[model samples]
Structures are given as C-alpha cells and as structure tokens.
Target: MVDVNSLAALLPDGVVVTDPDILGGYRQDRAQDPEAGTPAALVRPANTEQVATVVRWAHERGVAIVPRGAGTGLSGGATAQDGALLLSTERMRDISVDPVTRTAVAQPGLLNAEVKAAVAEHGLWYPPDPSSFEICSIGGNAATNAGGLCCVKYGVTTDYVLGMEVVLADGTVVRLGGPRLKDSAGLSLTKLFVGSEGTLGIITELTLRLLPAQPPQSTVVASFATLEAACDAILAITGRLRPSMLEFMDSVAINAVEDQLRMGLDREAAALLVARSDAPGEHAGLEVAEIAALCEKAGATEVFATDDPAEGEAFTVARRVAIPALERKGPLLLEDVGVPLPKLGELVTGIAGIARRREVLVSVIAHAGDGNTHPLIVYNPADADESARAQQAFGEIMDLAIALGGTITGEHGVGRLKKAWLPNQVGPDVMALTRLIKSALDPQGILNPGAVL
Candidate 1:
C-alpha cells in the first residue's frame, strides 16, 4: 500500500484528507452502491497542475484513482474503491465566457447552473440542462454526455463541448479540439472522452460552445386517461414540429410530485405531458396551440396551454422534481433506458409489465421526444425479497430496451449499476473494442478501475 502520509506531504496543506468522517462521505455517490469500498484518502485538487501531480503519484504506485464531480451522478460512476484515492475536483471552479467567440472555458468543478448563469450574462446559453444541473458539476456532465429536457431540441453535453483538457492515466495532460465551431482534426478524441465516465481520462477543463439566448417559451400541459394516449400525443407532436421541451410523467410520478409541490396536478390522470415551444414571436404560441390540439386529438382527458412564462415554469419545475419526490416513498433503483422514438411506447408499457410481474412500484418519467426514460423503481430496502425483485425488474427493463432496438443508457453513462447490461446492448465485438481503447489509454489501469470496462 502507498504511504498516504508521504502523499500528503507532497501536496499543499489541507489538500489531502484522511478523516474517517469525511472519507466516509466520499465512499459512495448519490447512487448509494452497497458495494462501495472504503477509500484510503480523499484529495481535493485546486488546479489542473495539482490534479496531474496526484495522478502521477497514483500512476507510479499503481493505486486506483476515482475521479468525482459534485457526487450527483445517478449512475455509480464515482463510487470509491478499496485502497483507492478519491480525487474530488470541487475546488477547481473557474470560468471565462467569450461572447465574441461564443464559447466558455470552464474548470471542471463549476456547477452546470453556474456555467449557464455565467454564459447567460453575456447573452449566450449553454443548452444541456440536466435535471441535476443545479447540483451536478460540468465535468460530470461531460463525463456522462448528459442530456435533459432542452436536449429534445437543442442537444446534449457533447454537442456543446467544442474542446477539453484531460489528464490520462499516466498523468499526461492533453488538450483536444478548441473553441472553433468545426474541426476535422486527427481523431474525434474530444467526443471519445466526453462520455467515457472517467475511465479513459480525467477531465480538467472544457471549451464549451454557446448559443444566443433562447426565445420566450410557450408551454402546454396535457393529461391522458392512458399512457398510450400520452405517447401517441408525443409522437404526433415530435412528428409535426420540434418542441423546445417534451416531457412525460406517469400516474405514480404525478402523484409523487403533487404530494410534495401541491401544484394542483391531476392525480387521477394516467400520464401527463408538458411540452414547450421557444420559436420566435407569435410562432411560439402557435406551436404550443398546435401541440395542445394534438393532445386533445389523441384523447387527452384535459388540455392546458400557457404563454405566461412563470406559470409554465411552475409546471416545468414540477416535472424536474420527480426523482426526489418519488424517493420519499422508499429506496429507488433508478434505470436510464432509451429506445428509438417509435419504440418508446413499447418501452414504457414493457416497463410497466415488468413492474407488475416483479411486484414493485415503478414510476417512469421521460424526455419523451428523444425517447429517454428514467424508470424509478421504488422498493423497501428492509425487505430483502422485495429489493431482489426490484433488482430483477431493473435488469429485465434494460433487457427489454435492448430487445426493442434501444440502448440500456441514453444519457447517464453505464456506470457500475448498468455495466452488466452494456455488452448485451453493444455486443461482444464493440465490448472488445471498448476494452482495447481503455487498455491503450490506461495501460496501468489506475484510472477509475472497474467502471465501464
């Protein structure tokens, strides 16, 4: 084992921490993986140079290094391991927005909401708006290639990422891509690391592309008596026009959100759809009116439209709080599964069937326009049999998604929780290629061991 005392001596004071209380907090991320192991020490690096120094020490000693960002990942990507060094980038928050170039250079530790606010001051927008944007770090966003509500129309993290500075396993720092809009460089290395989930390298800085401020949005809220009707409305809306945001929540999620927010949501509705349009001028209202019409045509139980931004925002906030709201019921086994747009209905219905068969409560909320769903499986941890059943249903849902020509994970990376089903979706050939790339980039295997590979 490496001497942590000597490691601490090498860095600045207070940079290395061995307090059991603090180390205990770093052992597991929000995923709460039961298998999370105790880390030897936690290191908070303030700059890329310090990060490289720590990586070099770990590389030399062949000690595993787990890179973490704000610890908000739904996947267990940042779970600590035995005898590993927990490298937290929470101290490296710095950002510079260049309105002239429409880009921002940000350190990894900046929160997504902080990045958005910084860029917005310059009349620019950072489009990727993950539900956890207020809490998640920008580095984690790039690490997972996270998508969100606006992604239905704008794009995900990789789309906004023009360049990044990454530290490889051997402590070599390299810069890939740049602020330019287009680049046909040697390889698409920037994108390769964007969603690597810290297995390939540790992201230190990102050069993000930004767009002009979004237009005022017109929102539409619709309720359906059945899930199929809501899905039909989603397909119709996406097919007719691209809405700025298209979200879905089932009866369980609606009730959960209502219980917390008391926003007067229709608890009797089987499913709810919240669609928004940010088109220029009167077109925004026109688009939402058209979407409301489609919902009504699809047999919606109730249809509501609002051009009032605050009222629309209240509904949007309700949709965003679904996960935490559902967690109040019991422990959750979250699944991020996605399918082709046409297969979305089958995916949701199949998950409901799995829930019934497994005897677990599954609440599904989705970025419906893009076909990515967050299936929150609620179960009582005190009951081992019930927990086991939830686990079984979780795997089965991923299997169903794979069978439906879909992916096991759409936005959230295949962290430890979903690692088992990755090969099933991508097949052996792609798995081999993935392993080959990982080995080539991290020959010492000291960077985020036992993650994707």
Candidate 2:
C-alpha cells in the first residue's frame, strides 16, 4: 500500500484526500460503470505544477493515476481503478481571452459553457458546443474530441484547439503548439493528444482558437411521418449547402422532450429535425427557405421556419434535452456509433431492428448532418434478462456501424466501455501502432491504465 501521509505532506493542505466518503464520489464518472473500483485517494490540484507533483509522486511509487475532468463523460474514460489516484482538475478554473489574437488560454477545469461565455465577452465565439456544454468541462470535451449541433458546419473539438500544455507519465510538463493558427515546426503531437483519452498525457492548459460572434441564425423545424423521410431531408440539406446546425430526434426522443418541456412538439410525428442557417442577414433567411423547401420535397409532414432567436433556441434546447428526458424512463446504455452519410438511413433502420429483436427500448438522437448517432438503450437493471439483452444490443450496434464502414465512436472517446470494439474498427496494424505509442510514452502504464489500449 502507498503511504498517504507522505503524499499529503508534499501538497497544500486538503489537496490530497483519502476520506472514504470523498473517494466514493470520484470512483466513477457519468459512465457510472458498476464495476468501477474505489480509488485509493482523490487529488484535487489547482494548477499545472500541483498536477505535476501528484504525477511525479505516483510515477515514483508506481501508483496508477486516472485524470478526470467534470465527470460528464458518457464513456467510462474517467472511471477510477482500484488502488489508483483519482486526479480531478475541478479547482483549476482560470481563463484568459486574447481578443487581438482571437484565442483563449484556459485551464482544464473550466466548464465548456464558461469558456464560450468568456470568449463571448470579447465579441468572439468558440465553435465546439457539446450538448452538455453547460456541465461538461473543456478538458473533458478535448479529451473526448467532443462534437455538437453546429459541428456540421464548424467541426469538432480538435479543429478549434490551437495548442495545449500536457503533463506526461514521467512527470515531464511539455508545451505543444501555441496560439498560432498554422505551425509546421514539429510532428502534430498536439493533435495526437487531443483525443488520446488521457492515455497519452493529462492536458493542463489549452489555447483555443476563436471566431467572431455567430450571426443571427434562421431556424427550421420539420416533422416527418416516417424515419426514412427525415433522413432523406438531412441528406438533401447537407448535399445542397452547409447549415449552421442540423439535428435529428426520433419519436422516442421527440416525445421524451415534449413530455418534459410541454413545448407542443408533434408527439405523433415519427421524426423531427431542427436545422439552422447562420449566413449573413438576408442570406440566413434565404438558406432556411431553401431548407424548408427541401424538407417539404422530401416528404415532411409539417415544416416551420422562424427568424426569431428566442423561438429557435427553444427548439435547440428541446433537441439537447432528449437524453435526460429519456433517462426518466429507465437506466440507459448509451452507444455512440457513426457511419458514412449515405449509410445514415440504413444505420437508423438497423438500430430499430436491433431494439425489436432484443426486446428493448432504444431512443436515437443525432448530429444528423454529420452522420453521428447516439442510440440510447433504456433497460431496467432490476431485470436480469432485460439487462443482458440491452448489453447485447450495445455491442451489436457497434458491429453494425463497423459493417457499414463507420467508426465505433464519432466524438466520444473509446474509454473502457467501447475499447473492446476499437480493434474491429481499426485493423491489427493500427492497433499494434497504437500500443507501440502507448508503450513508448508510458512505459510503466501508470497513466490511465486500461483506457484505449
């Protein structure tokens, strides 16, 4: 057993905590893996130096360290291991926005929404907006390479990350890249670590690129009588031109949101789409008009357009709240599977088939324009048979995605839960190369053990 007293003495008082009650809370992240083990100690570091101290002590002692952000990860990437030190970056909330350079230097603990708000004060915007932006930390977003509703036009987390500060396994603090938009000086080490899922190193500070504030977006809400029609509209819209936001919710998700917000969503519609266009002034209106025509041509049951920001945001909020709304039904086994745009319809239909064959309820919502789908499998854990079925469906969905030449995860990292399917997606050679890199960077495997590899 490691000596807690010696470790505690090296840091400020209360930085190293071993209380059982406190340790319990850090054992699992939002993945909530039942098998997650109790961490030996929980370390709350305020800055990069403090984080390095914890890493150095753990490296010398061969103690495993699990780096965690806001604990909002859907994958089990932040799940704690037995006898490991859970290093939470929650207290390191600090950010400096540089309006001149259109960038923001932020500590890892700041929430995603806070980062957006900070940059907004300078008449700038951060493009990556995960649905949990309000609760998920910027560190976690980068760790997972998160995406959002607007990612169809803007791109994901990696696109906006100009640089970052990382603490490696051996306690070495390295700075990679910087605020410069273009840097070809070295290997793209910065991009490599962006979605490494804490297996490569712990991110301390990130220099994020910012854009001028977004223009007022015109919104289009379309309802379809069948899932197939909604998917047709998605492809048609994306094929024509890029939209600021394009989102999809099936009947399960639509009714779920309606149940919670009483927003008067078409509860009887088989599918709903919330699309947006942020082109300059009149162009925004023209884009939505074109989108509405495409939806109507694609067999939409009803289509509504609005230039009012408040009205548009209300629908965006409805799509964003689908997860929590469905959670009210039962515990969920979430699967993030994405396929090529052409295969979107096939994947959606295949998932429905899986739910029926497995005798489980699965609700799917997606950043439809980008072809990434989140299928929520609702099952009662109290039932042994139902729980087993849900687990089977989870693996099957990933298998289906692979069959269609798609990835196991789009934005969410392969954390522990989805690591099993990673090799299937990436062939043996890539897996071998991944292992080699992991071994070279973390020979002792002290950093985020059992993740990715």
Candidate 3:
C-alpha cells in the first residue's frame, strides 16, 4: 500500500486527504466508469508552487498522479486509479482579468461559469460553453477542448485559449503563450497540452482569450414530423447563413426533455430543432425569419420565432437539460460522435438503426450545425444482456462515425472510455506520433496513466 503519511507530511494539514469516505467521491467523474479504482489519497493544491511540490513528491516516489478539475467531465478523463495520487485543483481558484487586452489569466480550478461571469463584469465574454459549464472547470475545459452551443458560430476552447502555465511530469512549471492575440512563436506548444487530457502535463493556469459581450439573439424553434425533414432544414440553414446556435433533438430526446421541463414542447413531432441568430440589431429577426422559412420548406410541423431573450433562453435550457432528463429512465452510455456536415443525416439514421438492431433506446441530440452528435444509449446495468448490448451499440456508433469520415469524439477528449476506439479513428501513424510526444514529455508515464493513450 502507498504511504499516505509521507504525502501528508509534505503538504498542509488538510491538503492531503486519505479518508476513504472522502476519497470515494473522487473515484469517478460524470462518466461514472464501472472500472474506476480506489485512489490512495486525494491532494488539493492552492497554488502553482503547491502543485509543483506535490508533483515533485509523486515523481520521486514513482506514484502515478491523476490531475483533476471539478470532475464534470463526461468522458471519464479524470477517473481515479488504484494506489494513485488524485491531485484535485479545486483549491486553485484565482483569476486576473485584463480588460485592456481582453484576456484573463485564471487558475485551473475556477468553474467555466465563474470565468464567464468574471469576464462579463468587464464587458467581455468567454464563449466555449460546454453543457456543464456551470459545474465544469475552466482547467477541465482547456484540458478537453470543450465545445458547446455557441461553438457553432464562435469556436471551441482551444480558440479562446491564448496561453497557459502548465507543470511538466517532473514538477517543472513552464509558461506557454500569453495575452497576445497573435504570436507565431515556438511551435504552438501551448495548444499541444490543451487537449492532452493530462497525459502531457498538468495545467496550473490558463490565459483565456475573451470577446465583448454577445449581441441580442433571435430564436427559432421548429418541429419536424420526420428526422429527415429536420436534417434537411439543418442543411438548408447552414448552407445559407451562419447561425449563432443550431441544435437538434430526436423524438426520444424531445419527449425526454419535455417530460422534465413541461415547457409545452411538441410531443407529436419526430424531431425538434432549436436555432438562434445573434446578428446585430434587426438583422437577427431577419435571420430567424429566413430560418423559419427553411423549416417550412423542409416540412416542419410547427415553427416558432422569438426575439425575447427570456423566451429564447427557455428553449436553450430545454436542449441543455437533455442528458439529465434522459438519465431519469436509466443509466446512459453516452456517445459523442461527429461527422462532416453533409454526412450528418446518414450518421443520425445509422445510429437509429443501431439502436433498433441492439434493442436499446438511444436518444439523439446534437449541435447539428457542426454535425457533432450525442447519442445517449439507455440501459439497466442490473440487466447483464442489456448492458452488453449497450456497450456494443456504443462501439458500433463510434465505428459508424469513423466510416462516415468523422471523429469518435468532437469536443470531448479521448479519455479512458473512448481511448479504445481512438486508435481506429486516428490510425497507427498518428497514434505513434502521439506516443512519441507523450514519452518526450512524460517518460515515466506518471501523468494520468491509462488515459488517452
């Protein structure tokens, strides 16, 4: 067994926690992998130096370290391992927003929402909004290169990340990039660690690029009698104008969300599309009007357009709550597969076919504008057969995505859960390059062992 007493002696009194009950909470992230292991101890560091100290200690002792943020990751990126040091960055919450440069140098532990709010106070916005932004950490966002609704128009986390302060595997802290908007300096190494999922190094601080607050948005909610019609509308809308947000939900996801929100969603529709336009001034309304027209041409059963922010936000909330709403039925095997825009319809239909063939209830929700989808496969873990089928369908979905010229995961990182399929997606050459980079940075393989690799 690992010596917890020695680790305790190096940090503050309460920094190293070995209490079984407390460690239990840190075992798994939102993915809730059944294979999650019991951690030897949990370390909470308040500053970069404290983090480096913990890493140095662990490196010397040859103890594997798992760097974690708020643990809201949906890909099991932060799952704990047996006899490993669980390094929690929760206590490293600190931020300094530079209004002049429109950049914020924030510690990894700050929640994504907290970063947005802090920047908003200075009339700026940080727009890489994962669905769990309110609960996920900025460090975790950077770690996973998370994407969200606004990403259809804005961009992913890597786009907003100007620079960061990361700790190498051997406890060496190095600063990469900065508040500068344009810097072609030195191999773009800052971005290399952004989505490394802790296999490269531990991110202690992030310098995030920000923008001025968003403009008023116009919303469009359309319901289709068939999934094909919805896809047609998606193609039509994207082929024409750039929408601020374009999201889709199939019959299963629509009913599931409606069951929870009771917001008078169209239950009879086979699919729902909630889109928005954040163009300046009256142009927002014009954009929504054109989108509504496209929905009609695509055989929409009903169409609703709104310029009121409150009304639009309500629809957005319903889309965001889809995963939780579906979880009410049973445990979920979530799949984040994405394809090229033109191939999206084929991907969605293929997933439905997989669900039917596997005899499982798979709900499809997506950032349709970008062709990234989340297929939620519901199953009862107590039922061995059903669980096995769910697992099979999960792999099949990734396979289908790969065949469709897409990725196994879009915004979510290739954590422990998705690592198996990653080799199939990126092929042998890319995988070898990845290993070379990982080895050069973490030769001991002590940082987040068994993850991404």
* lDDT scores in order: 0.94, 0.94, 0.94
| Model 1 misplacement above 4 A | none
Candidate 1 global TM-score:
0.99
Cα lDDT tens digits for candidate 2, 170-201 = 99999999999999997999999999999989
Better of 2 and 3 by lDDT: 2
Give the lDDT of residue 199 in candidate 1.
Answer: 95
Count clashing residue pairs per candidate: 0, 0, 0
Compared with the true structure, what per-residue lDDT tens digits does model 3 show for residues 1-453? 888787688778899998999999999999998889998999998998988988888888889999999998888999999999999999999999999999999999999999999999999999898888899999999999999998889999999999999999999999999999999987999989989999988999999999999998989999999999999999999999899999999999899998999999999999999999999987887899999999999999999999999999999999999999999999998888999999999999999999999999999999999999999999999999999999999999999999999999998888999999999999999999999999999999999999999
lDDT tens per residue, model 1, 288-353:
889999999999999999999999999999999999999999889888899999999999999999
The list of candidate 2 runs beyond 4 A from truth reads none
lDDT of 3 at 36: 92
lDDT of 1: 0.94
